[model samples]
Target chain A: MATFMDVHRGMTGITDEQLREAHAADLAIQDEEGVSFEHAWADPDSGVVYCLSEAPSPDAVQRVHERAGHPASEIHPVPLAV
Target chain B: MATFMDVHRGMTGITDEQLREAHAADLAIQDEEGVSFEHAWADPDSGVVYCLSEAPSPDAVQRVHERAGHPASEIHPVPLAV
Candidate 1:
């Protein structure tokens, strides 16, 4: 599997609880798209949310997010990590 | 400490080894500025680098990055996680 990092913008005023709920919702249906969300981070101040996932392709990750009603603004393959 | 997510753009052609070296350089001086780098991810295709850190303030995180010579384009407080 390849690692991908996706970004969501314009999420100002979002709460921690809301983000967790959204992540949970994605998890519930991720397997259907062959995607596994590893972690999620949100910056309410900047209205940006980042998700790191392992998936067959970036398209799979986007599919899961779109189905969860939180489509990402940008998606990129993480070729390296540390 | 609060968690901060910083983004770096226009890093095209940068290599994984270069990112790791920069990260290590930051770690070497982070304590002097009350910052701790948690993880880093890079998208070679997109020329974006993301760094997650715990720090007393965003400025402190920026200082560490600046000293490491890889200043971030944006920094946001990560108020939520999942």
Candidate 2:
């Protein structure tokens, strides 16, 4: 498995409830794409959300997010982590 | 405390050993500034390294990285996490 950090933009003023819902949506169907959405961080002021996940590939990560209705603007592969 | 994702660029071809040493340096002095260096992700292909930390402010995160001899190029505050 590989780690990924995906960024979503244009989510200004996102509330905690909304973030939770979105994360839950990803978790619900993550297994379909062999992805695990671990945690998410959001800066509502900047309208940017970062999601960390472990998946077979970046495509799998994107599939999970896209299906969850929050397509990422950028998906970065974190090949090395510590 | 707030979470931060700091970016360091222009570190292409960094080895795993080098990354560990750098992370260790930050861990050694993080307590002085009331910060905790959590985890780091690196994409040597893009020459970008991302460091996740809990800090009082972005300045504190940068100070630790700067002291570790690898100043961050960009630091984003992640005020909300789940």
Candidate 3:
């Protein structure tokens, strides 16, 4: 599976706890799309949330997020990790 | 400790292997500054890298990255989590 980093912008004022809940919610439904969410991070001040996941394609990742009610503004493949 | 997400810009063309090496190198030296790097993600096409870490302050995180020779363009605190 390829790794992906999806970004959600304009989320200013969103708290970390809210992100955690959203992430969990996404994970709960992700299996339907073959996406596995690994981690999530957010910058409350900038309103940018990032999610790391492994999936067949970016679309799968996006579909998961979309279903979770927080669709990403951009999704990019992460070809490296450590 | 608080979590942080640091962004590195203008890293276009950097491969996954190179990032892995850099992340490992950072981990090797991070303890000196009291920073614990948890994970790293890079978008090769966008020349952007995101690192998740736990540290006393953003400065400590910046110091570690600077020492690793990959200074961050921005750093933000993450105050909430699941």
Instruction: Give TM-scores of the second chain, every candidate.
Output: 0.96, 0.95, 0.95
Tens-place lDDT digits, model 3, residues A1-82: 8999888889899975688789888989999999999877777888878778899999999888888898899998878676
DockQ for all models: 0.85, 0.72, 0.55
- Flag the better candidate by DockQ, 2 or 3: 2
Off by over 4 Å in 2: none
True contacts kept of each: 0.84, 0.66, 0.60
Ranking by DockQ: 1, 2, 3
Q: What are the clashing pairs of model 2?
A: none
TM-score of chain A of each: 0.97, 0.96, 0.93
Q: Per-residue lDDT of A8-82 in model 1, one digit per residue for the tens? A: 999998998899999999999999988999999998877899999999999999999998999999999988888
lDDT of 2 by residue, B1-82 (tens): 9889888989898878888999999999999999999999888777788888999999999998999899999888878888
| Candidate 1 chain B weakest lDDT stretch, 10 residues | B11-20
Write one digit per residue (lDDT tens) for candidate 3, span B1-82: 8899888889998897899888988898999988999988888988888889999999999988888888999898866554
* Poorly placed runs, candidate 3 (over 4 Å): none
